[model samples]
Target: MYTLAVCAEMVFRDRPVPERAERIHEAGFEVEIWGWTRHDLDALARTPAHFSSMTGYIRGTLTDEDGAAELLRTAEQSVRAAEQLSCPRLNLHGTGLDDKGLPVVPVAGEADGPNWIAAHRTLTRIAELGESAGVVFTLENLNTAVDHPGVPFARAADTLALVAAVDRPGLRMNLDLYHAQIGEGNLIELVRRAHGLGLIGEIQIADVPGRCEPGTGEISYPAIARVLADLGYDGTVAMEAWASGDDDLALERFRSAFTL
Candidate 1:
């Protein structure tokens, strides 16, 4: 069965930070955090929770202006966070585009530029930095049409292409199923493809139609989990879903859904 890590930002929004960590272990799951601050880090230190992964915005897009430099800076900062928090991976977004598919951080008024080249250069540098520091960089695709509209690189195929181009052992893609179901179908095939190529670094689960816990929407998470298990996917598959009922109940339901 796939392992589960709870996104503190999504389900534990109302709880205190330290208690959030405790609640995750209480429910028998690892903890995943977002946008952590000094207070959050200090509070996290006192907990016995295992931080599986961390994700947030970096200064630049993967293909926008100052993209490579900003990604490098974020990589440097991520290593420090990883060392302290014990989370070895940093998942981040690409330089976003507009509705018409242009860069959010344009260079001289240009939006769309050479996609593969920019991704290769930016990710390669970040990979080099992270490789030495015992951290890894992951590129995640989000649904722009739904919850995360307007961001480019919101497709599983796009991330696959980036991983092929970058060709770094320390660089990979985060297959977020909720967003992929919204923006790209063929979830099982995509997972198979990524697994075959060794490009999937992590997996995030939530049902489509709504970013709530599994079984609340059209997606069948049991089938998805079985597919991963059949393929020998031993990586972390975190539940980044929002809570629709009691948080404990929701966590229990999620754990059961992904149970092998």
Candidate 2:
């Protein structure tokens, strides 16, 4: 069976980071670390559990030499943080526009331009960094139609394409179900295809339209869980969703729905 990881960032909003992390860990689910600072690290040291994944941006385009250099520094910091925490993977976002309208793809481009080669070079460098620290760098798919509009690599296919281009064993895809459902339906087939190619490093789940618990929306998580089991993916299935009433009740139903 796959392990369940909860996104404690959105949940446990009223509690301290360490307490929230411990709460999720106590619930028999893995915690996905939101931020790793000196304080968070100190807090995590006392917890009974560890994190399954970490997600954040490098804050610049890989297409530019300076931006890529800055990204390398950021990647190194992230890798060191992951190493210290014993978290094996650091999640990254694919290239696209920044808030300043810069071409968030690497190396060279006009604002909003797609620079595949530069992006590839940048990810490869980060993968090398991850390899040195015994960590994997995962690129996540996003929903351009709503949540992450204007990002060049928002679809499952887009993320897979970049992964192939990067051609690094230390780099893979975070197959985000909610984003795939929004960008292009047929998520089960997509997951199967990604798993077959050994491209999936993590699987993030939340219901479409509402981004809530599984049963509150149209997504058939039971069906998704069956595919995952058939594929023999005994990994973490992260519940990155919002709870409606009680978080405990929502989590219970999520486990029941996705129980393999």
Candidate 3:
């Protein structure tokens, strides 16, 4: 059976974490993936025992070779927090990127040899931490055109490459069609390719013109859903939508389009 996870960022709307959790529960979603520590997670954890997952990051203080050790340490802490709340998965962003739109490096010419080595070491450490925690970590593909410019893993190939470098059983890719379509065309083809490489862990969608809701704009979501069903993908098809107007109306429209 395919499952659905709502990104709390889509539904919370700056509300209190407890209110967000109650709303999510009321909406009938059992599992969720929340954003970085931008909300009152402690209170949210107090919600009824439901399957949940959290998104976190390795601190920037852990980017160097000496810092790589702390990458796994912080990842372990994230895992501990998840386990405390019975969360099984932890979504991650790559080092070449930042989730909060903060620039990490100065305008460099290009990713040279030293850069690659440092990045690989940190990724490897993160994978080790994830494996040890028995908590799968996924590198999400961000929309470089609008949501995330200049971030690595903006391209599907780059995401695939990072997974390759991480090279761990616990490492995978959070395949967001919105970002993939924004950075690269041919969403179905990319899904097939990633499946062939055994890298896809989660899938998400929204339209192009506006990330309002699924099928609200130019995205052919039914075709993508067909591909997902055809591939027998046993993973979550998360709804990463924005509901600025009527949230329920947008959700209903998304449900109609994503009906499988």
Candidate 4:
């Protein structure tokens, strides 16, 4: 019941998306795309037959008001692709503290409560639009220490609260274990708590320190895996680790770790 999403940047290895899709299928896994754009339409157009197997599409950003609306439109297009391809989910990143390289607001500390409210409002609007497009919108949490150093809402509790505030049936979260480890040490407990709140919709995993494959870090992924199975987490378990030059070796490393 687990699947992997290939980040276009890591899998770019000079191979095209269609080739990546073929490789993923050959590896006995369904495919989720990290990022796709209009420019990719040409490469994607050539593989209409393979598109129906996509698990989900991760949309990058939609900061401004119009940009958010445009993202909804894009999600519509992605949903068409997903339905044609039989994909189930669409992941999204929230707005940052600023747009156009200027600080308009912040969403981290108590002082930025109003800013966070505005940001979540934007997220709610986007989520509604996504529902209209027939795609589930899941927010991804980024670790400020490793990646996405700006803005706020780094903690899983806070992100869960944002999802709660949004309160849309289709709005959910893409919980990244690496970022959760860096931002919140008690990842399993947090996962359990989020599950109790019915917030987590999808999950991704990678070890911290180097963002390498699982078992490369201090996190007890086997225990975490047990927790996930017990929680009845039926969503895709994407291996969102960084490329270590050899994908086959990395996949084997992850498979061994998880299986053992």
Taking all chains together, each candidate's TM-score versus the true structure is: 0.90, 0.90, 0.87, 0.80
For all candidates in order, the CA lDDT equals 0.77, 0.77, 0.69, 0.63
Show how many residue pairs clash in every candidate, following the order shown. Answer: 5, 6, 0, 1
| Residues 1-260, model 1: lDDT tens digits | 55788987777778786788888977888888865543368679778888888753345677645766775776677678777888878887666444343446544322254865776777887778768877777888777666655555567787778777888878888899988899888899988989999988899989877788988899888998899889989888999988988888789888888887
Error of 3 at 189 (Å): 0.4
How many backbone clashes are present in model 2? 6
Please provide, for model 4 over 198-243, each residue's C-alpha lDDT reduced to its tens digit, 9 standing for 90 to 100. 7877777788788877767788888887787787776667677765
At residue 65, candidate 3 shows an lDDT of 63
Q: For candidate 3, write residues 1-260 as lDDT tens digits.
A: 55666665676677765676677667766546565456555776787736545774545422366545655666777787787677777876544345565435322233556666776677677677778878787777776568765554446677777787777878888888888787787988998988888888777777886777875677888787778778878777777778757666666676666567
lDDT of 2 by residue, 121-239 (tens): 88888878777777788888877667765565667887888887877888989888988999899999999898888888899999877888889888999999998999899777999
Q: What shift in Å separates residue 161 of candidate 1 from its native position after superposition?
A: 0.9
Pitting candidate 3 against candidate 4, the one with the higher TM-score is 3
Each prediction's Cα RMSD?
Answer: 3.4, 3.3, 2.6, 4.2
- Candidates 3 and 4, the one with greater lDDT: 3
Give me the overall lDDT of model 3: 0.69
The TM-score, computed over Cα atoms with residue i paired to residue i, of candidate 3 is: 0.87
